[model samples]
Target: MSQTGTIAKKDALAAHPPAPPWAELDASCQLPVLYFLLSGLAWLLVGTLLQFEAGIRLLCPDWCAVCPAMTYGRLVPAAENALVYGFASQMGLGIGLWLLVRLGRTPLVASGLIAAGNVLWNLALTVGILAILLGDGTGHAGLEMPAYSQWMLLAAYMFVGIWGVQTWAHHTSGPYYASQWFLLGAMFWFPWLLTTAQLVVVTFPGRGVLPAITGAWFAGGIQHLWLTPLALAAIYYFIPVITGRPLRNYHLAVVAFWSLALFGGWSGPARLIGGPVPAWIVSAGIVATVLLLIPVTIVALNTGPVLGSRLGQVCENQVLRFLAVAVFCFVLVSLGNALNALRFRAAVTHLSLNEWARGFAYFHGFVALTFLGAAYHVVPRLMRRDWPAPRLVSVHFWFTIVGLALVVIPAAVDGLRQGNELNDAAVPAVKIFDQLRSVFGWRVLGLALMSAGNLAFLTNFGWLLIRCWTPGIRSAVALFIDQSGKSVTAR
Candidate 1:
């Protein structure tokens, strides 16, 4: 994460009055977000390609399990790392740096430290990604980084987090900026959640049942408090940018944030529903999961009118087109999660392909759509370049949407079929092979479409990258000295 701004302009403004100077961020943040979006699209392509998935499951005389590196076990985690770290986390860090400067209306506190932290963060993710492929993961999704790397990462985040919090304190009074709230909230949330989870889940020895509880706590907290907010912050910032309107109910934004904060921790055990975890623990999670509907409904209602009643207006802007799609996906995923929490529906989907379908929908609908929207709005602004290729943009969006549908909807249906066959218990174990066969072709088709979509996404992004850095398209890069505080120049 790095900051870019017009200091000469910021100095001129700050020289004038109480309002702080707001500098636009430099290309550093843009670069990582760009690269990862492309890379994530690449992995998204791979996950859907099913070429490897098929080969892993078959072709060899021996079973794939013997080769852990090539198995779905490794591939799934590795693919997810591509998304969570390669794509989302880096993008989040990059954007968070920008928002810290812009919303704070001041320069970053420790430019060098932020840069160093970013380097370490990327390095940690790199080690973590390879570790996953090598089957050396800590066995946690978000915490896949080995323990040593995580320690370095932990120290690194402290620097960036300090920059964010200091900059936030410097921001002036205004209409409560929802994006700022999310950003500041995230400044507090991520590390706290990480450290808390680390102590209980990793550092402490709570083997067996106790460790399970701690593990659930760690995972759910990360998704809800850390990752969820970054996605929401992006949503809050970009949706308004696209719709060209304030949230329909600004107060509801507060409600949604607090609601998520209050109830987010006690959920997601709906995920491990059939497992051997204690019943009350699972029931508590069920209740919290269901309660999440309140925040979800509020978010949906607030955005719906602005985005919903004026669908044409919303999509008139291509950026909003993606955002509108993400918002709809958010609503769908939230509602689905609520429904999925119910015992009835979960009975048919527990640990099955349907589970994957739901996850895919959430990933595509909420996280991917949000980031795609972010990319569309961000790239042009950062480079000050003419829009790259309208045809490519439209094609990329359509491909992603269609590919998501193919993967999520079909997998969800197949998951139901698979779960139903297995959960019935009356069906002999011998029939499990038949159930697996039914979903095989669908997985293959879905992966192919997904790969096509990713290729389109990467093509458009790569073209923009080439065009932006070209000499002819160059814009004068802006820099300014920090007057009010010690110079924000990297140490």
Candidate 2:
């Protein structure tokens, strides 16, 4: 308690600073993350192909007219389901688990269980997509998988989810990191939302319009609780690391976290603005959605200055570039959602392509981009090799951004036009469909470009894997040369 004793304690602690949390982890701990990432990429490829097929069908209804399995109604939902469950969820789990271990200062226990769970998770998604194409879909938005398939997904999630919970439980340090909170919240919240949706709309079939209400709720929850947190966690971790600065106003992170958790779950109902649901439900949803801006703004403020300081790095570092764009998209989508929640805008955008546009913006533009950036960082660390080709990374980045802009802009513009036309009783439904032909054509083109970008990603990932297994191909360190003109290894 004396001044001399306090000074001595401080000096000792500073001199013997603790080791980095990640240093405790070994290669075995990385296996689960790699498995999840590889599986996610595979699903992403499948989802992109399905999206292209669905887009083409929209543009030319008769392209596969003879095959009921290839019908737009079937293909579109299957594509959406695959992207959500197969690609997004799988990548999220992998990235989240890895971050938790690093931040929590603990090694991941139950690696085998996590791997097995991921296998079941992918298998369930496979079965679910097949069932949708084969006409056994639940017909609920965000819950399109058959009941049997849903159960399989949930069972697999149990194993993986347990690993996250146990990892958090085993943390050996004080003052939890921001990434840890978001990762833990996402891991716990998703299964709860999924199970509740199933029970309400599947097991105990809602009456009349109840199914629609529940479906809207489920869809909203997926974005706000699951996808948003996963993306935010990645952003929080990368921003500080990439910028070489601790977060500003770190204490406010707790406030931001609680605000999102409390408000996000209820925010889904805003999409049901004019539905048969009670007026209060719609009002509650709108308020919650608008309130979400608090947390979004907090995050932006926290990372803005740090990221701004490193603007130059964005061009040089592939990971930083992807992350910068992802953060921008996150803010854009959040504000857009708040604007869309208004009664006037909701009336115009409701049941229109605008919803699809927004969904794609969040999933592909924000969440998927974040995952891709994280992969750029995590893959090199795991494989101990720098990316084989910087050109491939550039190709993937530019194509994805351009493709998303093409898709989102056209979809929103056309959706607003369609909504206005639909409101005009004088406009015939057939005329509306005819007017959308050009928009659908643009969408098809966008989807094609997006698929091409994904292919580049796959190719790069494949090369990295090959090099990881092959001996003496090239040391990741040798990929770069130091100022002295000698080969320098990347750390």
State which candidate has the highest TM-score. Answer: 2
Tens digits of lDDT, candidate 1, 40-59: 45545554453436423643
TM-score of 1: 0.83
Top candidate by lDDT: 2
Q: Which stretches of candidate 2 lie over 4 Å from their true place?
A: 1-18, 21-26, 472-491
The C-alpha lDDT values of all candidates are 0.66, 0.83
Clashing pairs in 1: 4-25, 4-26, 48-447, 112-490, 354-415
lDDT of 2 at 227: 88
lDDT of 1: 0.66
